[model samples]
Target chain A: MPLNADQAHYLFSVMRLAVGARVALFNGRDGEWTAEVVEAAKKAGSLRCLGQAAPQLNPPDLWLIFAPIKKERTDFIVEKAAELGCAKILPVQTEFTNASRIRQDRLQAHALEAAEQCLGTYVPEVSDLQALQALLKGWDPARRILWGDESLVGPAQTLAGLTPGPWAILVGPEGGFSEAERAQLRGLDYVTPVSLGPRILRADTAACAAITLWQSALGDWM
Target chain B: MPLNADQAHYLFSVMRLAVGARVALFNGRDGEWTAEVVEAAKKAGSLRCLGQAAPQLNPPDLWLIFAPIKKERTDFIVEKAAELGCAKILPVQTEFTNASRIRQDRLQAHALEAAEQCLGTYVPEVSDLQALQALLKGWDPARRILWGDESLVGPAQTLAGLTPGPWAILVGPEGGFSEAERAQLRGLDYVTPVSLGPRILRADTAACAAITLWQSALGDWM
Candidate 1:
């Protein structure tokens, strides 16, 4: 397969890979494959597939739905989510969300980089920013939502009893969910409000913690 | 009480607080107290104690001992550790650790800011960077250490069987612990090697996830 200019530069100049050097590659769908460099140049390169290195290992049917915050923090959420084995990432515009728009391509790139850095075979998809209300209206009730409820910040509410299945964790913006939005979520049977201990966590911290909790309790971590 | 110049600038210039503006204060020892601004200026300020607002809520006796990585990531570990309710933060220089030094004061400030942002009553102390071997030499066996062992990174070894008390979580640097260091740690009776998950996590992500797992299972979250 022919490599892109950026990939060629990375392999030839940055990584100092020469022709015949072997590298692992993944397409987020195909299992990992080892490809040997057939041609190497400053701005162009080609590789021949050696064989499958490892089978594709997709994360559990888990998703992270969070209200976007600042650019750096939003990137952080996507990166950590990918590293922590989130299958999909959705950036939602909550009533109190500060960022009205997000660079979806940038976030998707972050997810890809995070997966590569973490030696992950699968890269989670980063969805474009969407309205939280609209997303919830079309949500599948079969996939439960673990809501990080700020009001319930106290001793940890163990997720031990929860069954393992399709699930998503919802974290609000820095300003938190508005009353109307909270009411709407609380009224939904698919949502389960959970506490993340006594301290009030920031949006990013809460997202990471909530994902860790869910994974260790009911997701792949178990 | 007299406010420092930085605090004054923050209150008067950044926050735009004037006389009679009330703010919550904590000494990391005393309970949270409400103070009314008596004088406010660009470089100086004063306040009068109104009353105690909330009792001091100290986190459980849990410590985070991590090998320092890059500057921003080191800062991140401190901030997340504070927000996650760690009682103390210790930066250890491991055999394969990259950063030779860390600014203790700056990291302490990050912890303080994180505590304030999270509405935490106490700020975790950021200790000066020390050699891992040295710290382990004088280590108290009574306080167990939860080691994020990269070798065991397959399944989530549930922490449910462990008991909580004075405990610490230790995360290695990006290069991970040298084989000698790993051997020494594994030999220690108080060290319990546990896996984070099926994927390799970056240093920052591992720190946050390990803290979350320990907190949710054996720390105050219980």
Candidate 2:
């Protein structure tokens, strides 16, 4: 397969791979394969697939829906979500969300980059920004949402005994969910309010921690 | 207590906290206290401790020893380690470590900032970078080290059934441990070789993941 201009530049200029050098390649659909550099140039490159190195492995059907924070932190959330084996990443605009808009393509690119760096066969799909109310309106009851509630004032709760199935983790904004939003979430049967720990965590850190907790409790980490 | 110049700038300049403003303070010895800013300036400030707000809370006895990676990522490791409730953070220079030197003061400051941001009462002490061999030479027999060996290719192992006393998580360098280093770790009776997961994680990610797994399994998170 012919490498894209960016990939070609990364291979030839950044990695300095010459022709005949083997590289691990994965398309998310096909298993990871060993590819040999057949043609290499500064701005263009091509490789021939040698053989499958490993089977295409997918993470659990877990989704991460977080309110976008700062640009760099939003990228961090996406990148960490991918690395922690989230199947999908969704950005939602909450009542207290600081960021007005998010670049979906940029976040998707970050997920792809994380997958490559973490040596994973699958990249989580990053969805466009959506309103929290609208998302709740179409909520699927079958999928449990582990709500990382910031206002939770008590000892931390464990994710043990949670059913192992389709699950999602919801990380609130920096300012946390508005009163009305909290009430709404509290009223939902599918939402399980959880605390990361005793201390308060930033939006980005909470997102990463929530994923870690969920993956360990109900996801594939066990 | 008199605020340092950096703290004064952070309060008066960055946070725009004026004189007479209330700020929470903790010295890791005393409980968290609500202090009033008696004097506030961009470069100079002071606050009188009013009263205790909460008791001093300490995390479980957990140490994180990791080989430093890139500059930013190394900072990230320290910050995350502090936020995740590590009792101590130690940077170890391994055979495959890429970075040459680590600014101990800078990393300690990062831990302080993380503790302040995360509302942690206790700040994890960031030790000066030391050689891995030297660290192992003085290893405490009672404290078990959860060796995050990248070479262990398999499903994630549970940290259950392990003694719940003083413990540490050891994350190797980006290039991973040398064969001799792995052998040395494996030969040690106090070391428990463990895998983060099936996928290969970056050094920083592995540190965070290993901590999360350890905390969930045997630390205070349970």
Candidate 3:
């Protein structure tokens, strides 16, 4: 096993790790691997795998499909979601959204950085900007999406009441999900509409809270 | 009760709300108020409170004490915390914190706008930055302070299992709390070390998640 060019730059330039240093590596599919640097270069480096250090920790098959806000907030969402062990990160577009040009490569790099920071084995894939309608067209019933529907009007809806299954958390943009989007969500039988709480959370906050609730409720808290 | 000066500007200039139009207002103290423009003026507008529509809603007696980061994030935290209904906000300086200039007036305006947006009556007060040790010197044993201690290596602590009293959430800066700070935190009987999860969350994410957890456990819910 060897460190990728991007990983090498982060380890060397960003973190300043030197030659003959040990670093944990995981290919998302394989279990954790401990690798030591055999060669160090500014842009690229090489490492040799010593042994498997830890088993791969699978995410909860949770997808975080949120409408990206500004550049920084969008980056924050991806990084936080990756650290929180989300299996997939999706950027969707809805009405009233302040459209942003998605730099998919940079965002993917952020996901990698967050995974490295949290010592997670898996890096959730970030999807391109897709229209909300196009996303609903190919929805699978088995993957229950827990909607952070702020307008659900009460605190009765919570992750504690939802049945565990393959899941996704859909959060709207800053302006929030439109009336049409709400209608579409309400019509979906498999969409479990839940409120984060009585207060109105910003879109980013709502996503994190929803994930925490699900993780606390159905994920690995036993 | 009309919108504040900043609110008036946003409403009239940005939102283009015309004269005689109605807008909703809440202070988290009084109930939601329905107010109408008595005169057309952006900088100097007049409005008459028609009546109280919804009764006032109270937030939990919790405080948020965090080290200031960049200007925008500091503003974001103030805005979000106000909307999330924290009773008070305090800025603390830890060993590794960078010097951050505060625009108190602008932040106070942001909090007001966030409150108006969320229709919350109670707005949290933002405090000036002070040394963490000085703030805790006169700590009340009756009121517990929970630290979102990232270094806590154990099972994910639940806020539900913690005490229900006047509480504050301690979030260090990006550099994290120093060893001496950690020792002080651990030494206090009133200090409860809690984990957002096994993940290393950014300070902002930790604050939101910590508040959400506390709200879910002890605050108002169905």
Candidate 4:
């Protein structure tokens, strides 16, 4: 594939890759491939695909839906979500959500960077921010939503029994879900309220813990 | 207990707590208690402790032993370790570890902050940086060590059947363990090497993932 200006800069300026250097590439759908630098320059560059290096191996159909907190911490959530094998990232607008909006493109970049750093073949797509109520209205019942309910304090309720298929983990904002939102979530048949642990984790930490718990219980980590 | 200068600054300046304000307090050994601010100042403060509010709720006896990396990332590891219910945090100097020294005091402070933020009654002790060789020499055989082995590929090997007791999770440096270190870890009988997941996790992320997996499988989170 012909490299863009940013890609060229990353390769030539940052990575210091010269002509004839080999690099690995993956585009989520296509398997990882070996690409040789055919023409390398600071402004423009191109790579010729050599061959497939690895078959496409995606994480389980898992999604991470979380309310955006601070910019850096939101970025951390996206990065860790990608590393922890989240197939999709959704930023939700909750009643107590601190951030009014999120830079979806920047979050996507963060996910891409995380995937690259973690040696992940697939990069999870980061969706634009959506209202929590609106998201719940269009929710798919087939996909189970694991709610990290802070109100139910104790050891994490085991997610063992639920058969793994399509799943999502919903983490609330720092202020937690409103009573109405909590009631709506509890009323939903698809929602399975689970505790992370006895301690009340920060928003970013809760996201990571939820992902790790889900992965360990029924996702690819098992 | 009388507050130190830093603690006083945190309480009076950062938190903006007024005299007579009730604040939660814990000292690792003692149960959580409600304290009334008797004297408040920017440089010094005092609190009068009331009766215990909550009994001591300690996490399972789990230790996190990790090779020191960059300063900020090292601090992150300590914070996450405390939040994830690590009873002790041990920074070890491996052959390939990037950081030569660590501010044990600062890291301990980070752990304390994390514990306070998470509403944890117990704070995990952060040990001074120790040589990996010396640490291994005094290793307790009875306490199992979960080695986050990067060499072992694929999904995490389950800790399902393993009985919960005193345990430790060891995470290597960003550069990863040297060949000799890898051989030594593999040779240890108490070490149960496990993969966090299929993808390679960064040192900080690996520590969090390892802790989450351990907690889900055997720790108090279960």
DockQ of each: 0.90, 0.55, 0.43, 0.74
Interface quality of candidate 4 as DockQ: 0.74
Query: Which prediction has more favorable TM-score, 1 or 3?
Result: 1
Q: How accurate is candidate 4 locally (lDDT)?
A: 0.90
On the 0 to 100 scale, the lDDT of residue B151 in model 3 is 87
Query: Which pairs in model 4 have colliding backbones?
Result: none
lDDT of 2 by residue, A109-211 (tens): 9999998887788999999999999999998899989999988744467787788899889999888999999999999999999877767778887887888
**Could you arrange the candidates by DockQ from highest to lowest?**
1, 4, 2, 3
TM-scores for candidates 1 onward, in order: 0.97, 0.94, 0.86, 0.95
Positional deviation of B148 in candidate 2, in angstroms?
1.2
lDDT of 1 by residue, A1-222 (tens): 999999999999999999899999999888799999999999998999999998888998999999988888888999999999999999999989878899999999999999998878899999999999889999999999999999888998999999789999999999789999989989999999999998899999999999999989887888
TM-score of 3: 0.86
Superior candidate under DockQ, 1 versus 2: 1
Q: State iRMS for model 2.
A: 1.8
Q: Compared with the real two-chain complex, what DockQ does model 3 have?
A: 0.43
Ranking by TM-score: 1, 4, 2, 3
The candidate maximizing TM-score is 1
Ordered by lDDT, highest first, the candidates read 1, 4, 2, 3
Q: Chain B alone: TM-score in each candidate?
A: 0.95, 0.94, 0.87, 0.92
lDDT score for candidate 2 against the true structure: 0.88
Candidate 1 clashing pairs, residues 3+ apart or interchain: none
Greater DockQ among 1 and 3 belongs to 1
Q: Give the TM-score of chain A, superposed on the true chain A, for all candidates in the order listed.
A: 0.96, 0.94, 0.89, 0.95
Tell me the tens digit of each residue's lDDT in model 2 across B130-192. 999999999888999999899874567777777899999999988899999999999999999
